[model samples]
Target: MTAAFAATPAFAKDVIVQMKNQGAASAMVFEPSFVQAMPGDTVKFVPTDKSHSAQTIPSMLPAGVAPVIGKMNQEMSIKVDKPGLYGVACKPHTSMGMVALIQVGKGPSANLATARAVKLPPLAAKRMNPMLAKAR
Candidate 1:
């Protein structure tokens, strides 16, 4: 079974999303890209000594919520305010297929259909398959 935030009372919890490279190819990626969160949860995107900026995809954000963008390792903390799926990408490394998915709220799911229908680039499409499959 997947993790559910409903069982826990709403509170401020922080989840760190690391922007780094892995293996020989030095494939840039968002460590633990697929994350489960609740409203009021804070997702922080952290980069190494290098550069990386986090931003929400317009089409992938929930309805009525404004998209968020964070500067490099200098400043990055997204406070979720609604229950839905959020798509995050590294503005500089998106072409390298760097992407992340965040689910906010209880179990079952919310705004997933809309989130899945979003169109992504080739590399992103490939890396996102497994992440999306596990969302619930």
Candidate 2:
């Protein structure tokens, strides 16, 4: 883990959402369901492939919020001082179950809402799939 990962505040720890060579579909869903963070937490989405990206959209987020695009492995930071669920996903693989759930607080239920899971366009898999495998 890098200093940034460890330096994550007690309330929030740096979480890594890693993409796999299995293809864009694999990158879509994080093996672990819930990524925990605090008020000022930073999460890094390390795309195995350069084409992959982690983006947030208002439609995807809770009400009264706008989506922010965080480039893969770009070291984006998030502050959830208030209480709510944040939704995230991969643009290329949204069609193929590539969704992430971020819980920003410690309490009863995170109550994070689910985002639309999309299936990887067959061609998208063909284009981005091998790029990741070669990286490994």
* Most lDDT-accurate candidate: 1
Index of the highest-TM-score prediction: 1
Q: Residue 128 error for model 2, in Å?
A: 22
Error of 2 at 72 (Å): 6.3
For 32-129, candidate 1 gives per-residue lDDT tens digits of 77899988889998886477788998888778879998887655788887888889998888888889989888645667777778788889877777
Q: What are the clash counts of all predictions, listed in order? A: 0, 9
Model 2: how far residue 85 lies from native, Å: 1.0
What TM-score, computed on C-alpha atoms, does each candidate reach?
0.83, 0.57
Off by over 4 Å in 1: 1-10, 23-26
lDDT of each: 0.80, 0.52
Question: lDDT of candidate 1?
Answer: 0.80
